[model samples]
Target: MTSLTRAEIGALGEQLAVEHLRTLGLVVLDRNWRCRYGELDVIAADDATRTAVFVEVKTRTSDRFGGVQQAVTPDKVRRLRRLAGLWLAGQDKGWAAVRIDVIGVRIGRQRTPEITHLQAVV
Candidate 1:
């Protein structure tokens, strides 16, 4: 298969992440939600737990910089939190809890893309 562009890779990674979330029974509320502060890659709700999960997707062809786990720095987490808050502010529904999740999608290394999910990341 041909290599995908960076933005295409990102979009594919997010699509895979959404499928993963659905498999876990989370209802996808929004995707690519943006604000002046930043963008939220995925916004999902766990109705069973009454929680809102904000996901950040990082798609890489290689780990030259760092692994997916290492890609999210403290500063990035803070920014994601702020963006999540902005998204929540526009919602009429209330959630008992809010969480930040990171999903790393590694592609072109195998027959299928690899996904790693870190939930409730601080």
Candidate 2:
């Protein structure tokens, strides 16, 4: 078995997150959206709720250092919240509600990837 690179792992995690969000009825508006401050991993819309969601994805091969979710620190959550505002400023239409979310992906040997989605993180 071969190990994936950091970029590859992150890409896989984001893709999986998008798929999972879509399954939950969210329409993906963008991925890897960047601004002068930082990047937003995923931006999606919950049509039913008229809400815009900003998602941060963290991928890890193991929990030796920390769990994938632990990677999203308070500072990171704050940054994501700011980035969400920046994203909205660039949008033509307004959303009824906005939220920040975190998606943790863990890939282990001989096992399917594990995904955890935490909404309204910030």
Scored by TM-score, the top model is: 1
TM match of model 2 to true structure: 0.94
The CA lDDT at 101 in model 2 is 86
RMSD of each: 0.8, 1.2
Whole-model alpha-carbon lDDT for candidate 1: 0.93
Candidate 1 residues 1-122, lDDT tens each?
A: 68778899899999999999999999999999988888999999999999999999999888897887799999999999999988888999989999999999998888899999999898
Residue ranges of candidate 2 with Cα displaced over 4 Å: none
What lDDT score belongs to each candidate, Candidate 1 first? Answer: 0.93, 0.89
The global Cα lDDT (0 to 1) of model 2 is 0.89
> In candidate 1, which residue pairs clash?
none
Candidate 1: list runs displaced more than 4 Å: none
lDDT for each residue of candidate 2 in 24-114, tens digit (9 for 90 to 100): 9999999999989999999999999899999989887878768756788899888888899999998898799999988888887437888
